[model samples]
Target chain A: MIEVKNLSKTFTSHVKEPGLKGSIKSLFSRELVTKDALKPVNLNIEQGEIVGLIGANGAGKTTLIKILAGIVHPTAGEAKILGYTPWERANEYRRQMALIMGQKNQVWWDLPALDSFILLKEIYQIPDAQYKYNIEFLAEILMVKDQLKTQVRKLSLGERMKIELMAALLHNPKVIFLDEPTIGLDISAQKAVRGFLRQYQKEFKPMTILTSHYMEDIKELCPRIVIIKSGEFVYDGSLSDVQKMMGDEKVLSVTTQNGVFKVSVPRQDLAKKTHELFEEHYVLDLNIQDPSIEDVIESIMKNGIGAT
Target chain B: MKWWKDVMGMELRKILAYRSDFWITFLGQTFIQLMVARALWQAIFETQGVSEMQGFTLEMMGLYYLIAPIGMKILNGPNFGFLAQEIYDGTFTRYLLYPLSVFQYKTLTYLTYSLFYSLQMIILLGIYRLFISEVAFTSVDVGHLFLGLLLFIIGAIAYCMMGMMIEMIALWADNIWSLAVMLRFFTSFFGGALIPITFLPVWAQNILVWTPFPYLLSLPIRTIMGLSTFQEVTQGALILMLWTLIFMEGVKLVWKKGQFKYTGVGI
Candidate 1:
């Protein structure tokens, strides 16, 4: 449902020195500098698949999403979401897709969420019957039915987010792009959003791409993970494969007569290493397990995935 | 069509939600302006010892001040500060995500604000007419009145487009508040909303006539007051339409170029 080929975006900004002199100088001659926000990124997301986009700050995950959502045009290459060129911004493309930015708001701040919902209804040209059903279902799932009448500014962050999600989904979009949807929310609120997204994806089978700093959001909702660094994807595979990429590293715990000792070793060397240790010491209990996802991701983030 | 109507309805509700602010900005502020202009014009006519100044009788002066505020509303439309804020803060992403055009959305919003503003001015004028005894109502032909209203709508659109172009400059500049203030002062002084264009020096009036600023406020006011001949009104309307097209093209060009620089920063 989504395809991106060599999709890249470059941002150019003017550099000013300082003070009144610099300001005047800038007016006369602006020093232009270019930064690559995204570098020839490629990804293909199939229908009914939910992919987690993981990257450090300024790693181009959000840039990639914005490019696919048509908010920012690419400086080079192309991207198509559900068979429509996103940058062209065709009405059919917009109607069948939705982009939800957690830090940004789509609802009118002073008006009730229901009012914004009504506006979205017209915006997406949803049929009356379908709009009613979608709102009822989405509101009930997000547990914001009673809160829809209150002004958005008065609602809790979680409540507002629920309403935002409802607004994006009112048209029953075929593709969804979520950027930090769970950021700044309480744990329960985060859980609610993650749970809703999981169920929503299951029911609708829409291709979804989500970016969040929260590891739990990635672990719980995304079966396939795409990790990028420095404007390029370094790893793209299942959650378990990421551990394998961390290289056969397992945490080995041994409870001997001298208490317990924990050591890290490759999976291939575990048997020989453990046997040699058993011969040298009195081993009481031993356990071998792969490193946690967090440890692997941390190592990937600190050092490039290629290093792992 | 439904999308435009929806935006208009939502903007109306937003204005109603801040109805107190509406009263303060439109009624309280406009009342002060009218009183000040009335006092200034009264002193000028009294000092000159003449019943008329620049083809305006004392009653016509009173009528001009009465209508100037309404003309300002049409010429100013709603402030583009909201659009500027959106562009600066990166919330403009919301509009890009939606299927509707940002231009259409903002235009409809202005139209809604103008509708509410016109209603409020009519009510205020109704109240004023109850106490005033010698106010002149211009005897305009029906065809001319319709033509004037059409010209007024087109002129409002021109102002809106011009405002949008200025606000879109925020994508390049750090702050635009000063620019907006300067624009407001320029329009009020040279657009002939603060004083009659005929009262200005001949050279200044001649230059102002060549530009679109006067058509936005002064031409409509003069057309309604029957101060303009039918030929002048026709020519002014054509010039105003031409300016609207130019500003509309400018808006499109600025917005398209501005998007390339938009990193969706801040928000």
Candidate 2:
């Protein structure tokens, strides 16, 4: 459903230092710093598969998603979604795909979610019967049937995010691009979103690509994972592969009296490890051997990775 | 036909949802436009009583002044919106990524607000014409008025497209509001919203006459107020059509290029 070959996006940013002199100098002679938000990246996704993009803060997850969704053009390389070039963004290509961002809302703030949905239904040119049916099914599954009439600003974050999902799914898109779709919500809200997405994917079997820092979100939605650091992709495989490879380490802290702690590593295990020795016997130690996805990310960032 | 129905129906629902804001903006727009029109009419009389320039008797002059500005509220009202802010805030990406054209989205939204605002302004203009417009068109040729309204709508669309073209610059610039203000200032002054073009220095009017800004608001008023002969009106509409075509072409080019520049930072 989607193919991206060596796609890359670079942004030119102006760097101005603070201080009166620096500001004055910039006014006359501005300096630019080219930032590679996304290095040359490649990927492909088949129908009914969920792919997760994981990375550090400056990683290129959002940039890659934007390029694939046809919101931002890449500096180089080729990308096609649903057999049409994404950057060209033909109407046919747009109709089959939906992009959802959890942090930012697509629903109108002051108006009820129903109003935005009505507007989108016409814009998408959905037939009346199909539109009504889709909204009804989505509203029921997402538990937002009553909240549709409430003003968007009045809803809780979880409520608003559910409505956003409903808006994105109203047209029954065949491919979905989700960026941090479960961010800033309680665990229950996050679980609800994940459940709805899983059901949507199962029913429609659309090619789904998701990006999220929350490891649990990825584990819940996507079986395969792609990890990028500092713009270049470093890892791509199943979720278990990541935990076995880069994250083959465990966190062990023994809470003792007076908050004193010690590591429970056998003398035979690798002796070399960065162990944080607290003044108290609570020696917090870090080692390399099977860790969670979060710890792996921290290790990758900490270890000054050369390049991919 | 289906496309038009979908576009208009969507717009209607949006207006209904924001009914309160619609009434507030309409009332404010009518009061402000009328006040400006009244002041201009008084100034014209104070300077040259019963001036015949542009076929205005003192009464026709006052009514012309009144109609032109109220006509302005109808034409340019839809032209102002948050196209630029949406781009800067990354909210516009949702629309772009959807199965819709930016042209269709903007044009539909503009039509909705235009329908709501124009209805109110037309009613207010009717009441004002009854009491304050010293002389009215005795016949009130509905066909001419309809044609004038049609031209006005075309002009509004073209003008709003031009605004979108300028707003597209927000993809690159951090702050685009100043550029928007500058665009508005020139369009308002050159478009004859403040005063009739006939009173301007001949050379100044001659320079602006060729520009599209005048067609945006003034040409429709001219068509209805009978400021031009049939031959001149036909020629002017042709020029307006040319401007609209050029603006439409510009919108396509700018929007296509502007998408490349959008960072999608927030989205």
Candidate 3:
């Protein structure tokens, strides 16, 4: 449903040195530095696949998504979504896709969400029957039925996010780009959003590309994960493969007679066996076994010191 | 039809939802315009007799100021703030994702606000005309007034389009406030809010005559004041139509070309 090829975006910024005199000198004779937001990134998203784009701040995940969403013009390469050149922004192309940024609210602030949806319905030219059905479906799933008539500003954050989601999906777009769509929400709301997205994707079979800071969202919702760092694609495949890329550093956080004892081991099986009953301390206490993603990521960042 | 109806409906919904604000702003803006007209009348009466200024009689002057709010409703509605906002916040992408063009969106939104506010202006004008003795209603001028209104709507829509075109400069320009201030100042100055454009210097008046700014408010007022002939009204309408087309192209080109350089920052 979406194809991006050799896509790259570079931004030029004026380089100025420190101090007032240096700044004054640089103001007249400034140097230009080209910062690559995305470098030769290529990807193909088939219909109905939930792909998670993962990276830290300034990691180019959002940049790549914006390029695909037709918001940012790429400096080089090409992209196609739903039989249309995204950058062209044809009406037919627009009718087939939606982009939802979590930190951003799309609802008209002074008006009810329902009113905004109605305007969108007319703008998108959705059939009345289909519009009603989709609204009803999204309303029930997002649990925003009661709040639909309330002004967007009066609604809670979760309710507002649901409305934003409803507005994006109102036309049942064939492709969806979610940029940190679960950011700043409570855990329950986040899980609810993930569940709703999972169900929506299953039902609609849309091509979904989601970028998020929460690795759990990517781990649970996306089968395939793409990792980016400093404008380059580092890993592209399943979630565990990304974990394996950090090496077999099975982290075991043991809570025993001591408060906490964390071990960096090579194998999970051996760690679990040791934690079972085979090995015991003099005053054995609580035994905890978990190799969280944070430890793996920290290891990766530590290893990627000079690479950046 | 589909486009206009949707935009119209959006405007209607907005008025209904904020009916309190609708009434307050409507009255406040009308009163402000009325006072400005009254002050201008006092200044003219001090110099001249009970007769008209230029070709505008005292009664016609009252009527001209009375109905200028109708033009104001269409021309000076505050929708350009949203354009500046969308450009700054990067939510403009959602606009691009719509089947409607950005031009269509702005046009529809402007039309909506005009229709919604026109009703309020008409009601206020009706009340003043019925109750106030000084409020003019040369009664038999309905046909000309109606014709005048038809021309005014075109001028107002054209001016709003130009406003959007100017506001879109916020996407690239460092000083959006200056652009907005310039637009407001020019629209009122050339469109004849301070004085009837006929009274301005002939050279300045001739230049204003060629542009669409005067037609936004000045032409309709002149028509109401009986200072212009039917041929002049028709000519004014044609100039407005021409300017509307020009601003439409301006909007199209600015929006299309501007989106390319749009960084979509702050998302």
Q: Best by TM-score, which number?
A: 1
The DockQ of predicted model 1 stands at 0.64
Predictions' DockQ, in order: 0.64, 0.58, 0.51
Candidate lDDT scores, in order, read 0.83, 0.74, 0.76
Task: Identify the superior model by DockQ, candidate 1 or candidate 3.
Answer: 1
Candidate 1, superposed: residue stretches over 4 Å from native: A15-31, A251-289, B132-150
Give the interface RMSD values of the models in order: 1.2, 2.2, 1.6
Which of candidates 1 and 2 reaches a greater TM-score? Answer: 1
- List candidate 3 segments past 4 Å from native: A13-33, A252-290, A301-308, B1-3, B47-51, B79-82
Interface RMSD of 1: 1.2
What lDDT is reached at residue A273 by model 1? 90
Q: Kindly list the per-residue Cα lDDT of model 2 for residues A1-308, writing each as its tens digit.
A: 78889988889989998999999999788899999998898898898999999888878888888888888889999988889988788989888888899889887787788878877786677899989999989999999888999889999999999998988888888889899998999999999998998889889899988998788888888888888878887777787765555432345544545563324333344343333333434444433344556665555555533310
Choose 1 or 2, whichever is better by DockQ.
1
Model 1's lDDT to the true fold?
0.83
Better of 1 and 3 by TM-score: 1
What tens-digit string does per-residue lDDT give for candidate 3 at A57-106?
A: 89798888788777778999988887787877788888888989888877
How well does model 2 score by local distance difference test?
A: 0.74
- TM-score of each model, paired residue for residue: 0.90, 0.89, 0.88
Lowest lDDT sum, 10 consecutive residues, model 2 chain A, at A270-279
CAPRI verdict on model 2? medium
For B1-267, candidate 2 gives per-residue lDDT tens digits of: 355565576566656657777676656665666666667676867787655656556566555665665566555545444588888777887777766677777776676655565566457657766776626564345556666666677766766777788888887775689888888778767887666777778999889877887777677776666554567566667887787788788888887677778877676
